[model samples]
Target chain A: TQLLEQSPQFLSIQEGENLTVYCNSSSVFSSLQWYRQEPGEGPVLLVTVVTGGEVKKLKRLTFQFGDARKDSSLHITAAQPGDTGLYLCAGYSGYSTLTFGKGTMLLVSP
Target chain B: DTAVSQTPKYLVTQMGNDKSIKCEQNLGHDTMYWYKQDSKKFLKIMFSYNNKELIINETVPNRFSPKSPDKAHLNLHINSLELGDSAVYFCASSLGTGLGQPQHFGDGTRLSIL
Candidate 1:
């Protein structure tokens, strides 16, 4: 079984602070995806990185896929109160399935 | 307009009761999936249906059955629900069963067993 390990299970930060969350695994994936889920809502796809060592920026959120395709990171710059949510990283291997990581809950306070 | 939607945003029921959750997507996607989110916020895929055909079935219990009546609708029926079954159920859809396809999700159904 493939397992995706995520770091910093919970984060509390003031507005305008920067934070980074990580997702690591021993198994390589074909693609990686990042999702942000707010309270009482389903997860929304933030970005999808397909190539190794790929980086995609969406507004203040930047996502990086590891060079080996076994890890990924999500960096948030100048986070605001609206950026507070649960961030999840999912890896897609063969067979058209996704292996999700335990999400990191972010609480940004103004 | 809501792209993907699930009914009964909140479900509170007694143990051993049978329940069903309905999902519909208007995005005209060809694939749909059901996922369960545990208390620790781990989202796990339970099943996947493409064009009303079952393509992926995880190690979920047989009591949890997913029915796709058509390409636009997929419903899940749980028989004899247990306390461990209490979790948030989300429905998602994508254009195809490809690796890089972006999945659109609906607001999850929060199920609680008493």
Candidate 2:
């Protein structure tokens, strides 16, 4: 089984601060996705990176996929109180299914 | 209308009981999946169905059964539930199984085993 390990399991920051979370794995992936989930709700898809060394930006969030497809990163700029949630990274390696990380809990204080 | 929806958002049940969670998708997707999220926020895929065919079945117990009545509906039934079964179950669907097709998720059903 492929395992996606996420770093900084918990993050607490103030408004307008910038932070980044990393997702690393030992196996290559065909696709990588980032999701944000709120309390009592399922995860919402934010972005998907299919190619190695690809970068995608969504408003204050920027996502990047490593050249080897074994790692991905999520950067949040000017985080607001609404950005408080759980951030997860899932990788599909053309195997059985997508492997998800343990997720990083982010708390943005206003 | 919601793209994907699951009924019984919160379920509280006792051990050794049988229960089911229903899911429906209106996105006309060809693939559907069941995922479990534990308290540590680790999401694990339990089952995946494509065109009513079982595509992937993970290392889950036999007590858990997934039934796909149609392309748009997939349901999960658990028999003799254990305390370890308590978690949030999410239903997701995608247009295809490729990497380009992102899966849309429904509000999860929180199961609490008493």
Candidate 3:
């Protein structure tokens, strides 16, 4: 079974603060995805990194895949209240199934 | 319009009772999945169906059954639910059974067992 571990399970910061979350795995993945889920709602896709060492940026959020395709990181710059949610990292292992991380809960207060 | 939709966003039932959660995707995707999020918010894959065929079935208990009547619909039925079965059930769908395609999710069904 493949497992993905995410660090800093919970984070709370004031507005305009920056935060970074890490996802690590022992097995290689064909693709990695980052999702943000608000309270009472399902997760929404933020970005997908397919190639090793790939980096994708969306506004204030930046996602990077490890060179070995076994790790990923999400960096948020100057986060706002709207950015508060549960951040999940899912790794695709060349199959239709996905292994999701434990998730990082972010609380951004204005 | 909602791309993926799940019925009974909130379900409260007694233990030992049977219940079902319905999911529908209008994105014309060929694959659909059911995930369970525990109280601690740990999400795990329960089942995956591709074009009305069972593809992935994790170590989920037999009491939890998944039925895909067609490409656009996947439903989950639980028999003799227990307290441990209380969790948020999310339904998602992707274009195909391959990597690189992002899966879209529904609002999720929060089940509370008494």
Using DockQ, give the best candidate's number.
Answer: 3
- Taking all chains together, each candidate's TM-score versus the true structure is 0.98, 0.98, 0.98
Model 2: per-residue lDDT, tens digit, B18-66? 9999999999999999999988888999999999999999989999999
The DockQ score of candidate 2 comes to 0.71
In model 1, which regions exceed 4 Å deviation? none
Candidate 3: Cα lDDT at A107: 97
Q: Which ten residues in a row have the lowest lDDT in candidate 2 chain B?
A: B95-104
Candidate 2 C-alpha lDDT tens digits along A19-105: 999999999999999999999888898999989999999999999999999999999999999999999999988733788999999
The pairs that clash in candidate 1 are none
lDDT of 1 by residue, A1-110 (tens): 79999989999999999999999999999999999999999999999999999999999999999999999999999999999999999989966798899999999999
In model 2, which residue pairs have backbone atoms overlapping below 3 Å? none
Deviation in Å, model 2, residue A68 alpha carbon: 0.8
* CAPRI level of candidate 2: medium
Quote the RMSD, in angstroms, for model 2: 0.9
Arrange candidates by DockQ, highest first: which order?
3, 1, 2
Model 1: how far is B6 from its true place, Å?
0.4
At residue A106, candidate 3 shows an lDDT of 97
In model 3, the runs with Cα more than 4 Å from the true position are none
Q: Tell me the DockQ of each model, to 2 decimals.
A: 0.84, 0.71, 0.85
